[model samples]
Target chain A: GAGVSQSPSNKVTEKGKDVELRCDPISGHTALYWYRQSLGQGLEFLIYFQGNSAPDKSGLPSDRFSAERTGGSVSTLTIQRTQQEDSAVYLCASSRRQGEQPQHFGDGTRLSIL
Target chain B: AQTVTQSQPEMSVQEAETVTLSCTYDTSENNYYLFWYKQPPSRQMILVIRQEAYKQQNATENRFSVNFQKAAKSFSLKISDSQLGDTAMYFCAFMKHAHNDYKLSFGAGTTVTVRA
Candidate 1:
């Protein structure tokens, strides 16, 4: 893809339901990242992948939030037993590589837990 | 943990004029990077500019420039000749230069409304 792509631009799910968000990084990009933007808040880091390996998952909010990347191209974020507090925009970004390279972002998935 | 702060919750600018947004960060790492991102109503984040910590000279991109003060831990963005299209939420971000530390710590963002 020309840029980072995310599926299901908007999602509205009920509490206690599970939701899965997907992200497709740019072609040949080795570094992918996930972030959460709450209402009127800054983006909070969730996780990142470097060549299909997540070295840092410390930012995941809780045990209910989990993510996985496959073939180093696509990543999925899964939230189990979603809470109303989980309502926010889920953003995904990809860079040519880590370090000083700037990451390109997707339009993001607005997940609303009602 | 690195923290970025944008105290201004909202700002108004006249078209064809200039507006400056303030940002400050706390970090102990010597090598790092600073960035400014813009999010419009479309909800897509676009990189406006970036500055490396080691660079003494600030970074500039056309009408967008940054005043980066490493000692003060301040990185301010100056949008010259603001346009109506520039109305958006602007965010300041920080990233450490260490390996596998690709996560960006972002500020609360300043919403800029460019009025004609």
Candidate 2:
């Protein structure tokens, strides 16, 4: 696509329900990243994927939060048993290669756990 | 662990005026990158400007420029001739230059409002 694309721009899910967020990175980009932005807070890194390498999941807040990138192009972030505290905006970004390159971001999915 | 800090939670400026947003980061790595991102009500984060740690000259993009003090670990953004379109939440971010490190550590963000 022309830029990074994210699905379900807004989601309102009940507590304990699972939600899936999708991201389609820019065409030919080799790096993808997931971040979470809470109300009035900074963006927290969730995960990173580079090419075919093993994803860096150290930033995931909990085991309930998981992400997977398929074919190094599209990615999905799954939240299991979502809690009210999980209400926030999930952002996805992609860079040309990785190092020294600026990341392009998608509009983001605003997940509201009610 | 690297950390970015933006002390100002909110700032206001009149249209066509200038405003400076403060940012400071703590990083042990010698080579890294600093960035400023703008998020409007639309929820999209747009990159405003960035500075390479090794460069002595600051980065600039038209009305947006940065004052990067590597020694002080400070990277402040200066918006000249602020427009209503510039009213947004501005974030400061830090990233190491290592080949395997690509995650961006962001500050709490500063909300800028340009009034008429």
Candidate 3:
């Protein structure tokens, strides 16, 4: 793809319902990351996947939040039994490599938990 | 743990003028990276500029430049010839330079309103 792509640009769901947000990173990119942006807050790091290495999941807020990246390309973030506080924008980003390369971000999926 | 701070919650700048957004970060690591990202109403975070901690010279991109003070742990962005399109939420971010550390610590963004 030309740039990072996220699916379901907007989602509205009832509390306790599970929601999945998807991200397709740029072609040949070796690293992917997930972040959450709440209203009036900064970007919160969620998880990261680099090549074939073990993903860093230390930033996941709770056990209900989980993510997976398949074949180091497409990634999915799942929230189980979502709460009202989970209503925010979920963003995904990718870089050519890890360290010094600037990350390119997706438009993000705005999840509204009603 | 690294932290980035943008004390100013909001700022207004007249079009064609210059405005500087302040940022400060706390990190024990000697080598790291600092970045400024712009998010418009569309919610896409676009990289505006970046500075490498090891470089003594600041980074610049056209009308966007940075004042990086390593000793003071400050990295501020200066937008020259501001345009209406520059009105957006600007974020300052910090990341370690280690190959295994890629997480970006971001600050509470500064809302920049470039008015005509």
Candidate 4:
């Protein structure tokens, strides 16, 4: 595809329910990133993947947040037992060749946990 | 840890005027990247400009330019000839020099209002 693509433009789930957000990065991009943005807050880094290896998961707030990238092309961010505070926009971005280039972003998925 | 800071919470500029947005970052690494991104009502974020830490000369993209003071750890963006379309939330971000683990640390965004 020409640009990064994300699924579920908007997702609304119950507080205890689980949800998964998906990201399909630009073809040939090896570095993928996931970020969370709350209302009136900065973009918070969540996870990063380079090729098939993920070296950083320090930004994930708690055990409930997890992300995986398979085949080096698609990634998924899963939230277990979602909390009301989890409501925010989840953004996906990809960089070429291990952060040698600028990151291109996708239209994020806005998740609302009621 | 790398951290970006944008002190001004909100700013307004008249159309056709020039405005400067301030940003400061802290990092021990010598090689890194600084960026300015704009997000309007639409959810997508657009890159405005970038500055490579090695380059002393600031980067310019059309009406957008940056004043990068590496010693001061400041990367401020200057928008020349502001237009109504420039109104958006501006975010300053930083990335380290590490490979396979480059994560962006962003500052609280600044709301820019371009007035007619």
What is candidate 2's local distance difference test score? Answer: 0.95
* C-alpha RMSD of each candidate structure in angstroms: 0.9, 0.9, 0.8, 1.1
Q: Any residue pairs clashing in model 2, and if so which? A: none
Q: Please, what are the lDDT tens digits per residue for candidate 2 over residues B1-116?
A: 99899999999999999999999999899999999999999888999999999999999999999999999999999999999999999999999988798899999999999999
Give the TM-score between model 1's chain B and the true chain B. Answer: 0.99
The lDDT ranking, best first, is 3, 2, 1, 4
Q: Per model, how much of the real contact set is kept?
A: 0.90, 0.93, 0.95, 0.85
Error of 4 at B4 (Å): 0.9
Worst 10-residue stretch by lDDT in candidate 4 chain B? Answer: B95-104
Question: Any idea what lDDT model 1 has?
Answer: 0.94
User: How well does chain B match by TM-score in each candidate?
Assistant: 0.99, 0.99, 0.98, 0.98
How close is every model to the real structure, measured as TM-score? Answer: 0.98, 0.98, 0.98, 0.96
* Better DockQ candidate (2, 3): 3
Model 4 per-residue lDDT tens digits across residues A62-114: 99999998888899999999999999999999988777657889999999998
Candidate 2, residues A1-114, lDDT tens digits: the string is 899999999999999999999999999999999999999999999999999999999899999999999988999999999999999999999998876467999999999998
**Clash totals for all candidate models:** 0, 0, 0, 0
Off by over 4 Å in 3: none
TM-score of chain A of each: 0.96, 0.98, 0.97, 0.96
What value does the lDDT take at residue A86 in candidate 2? Answer: 94
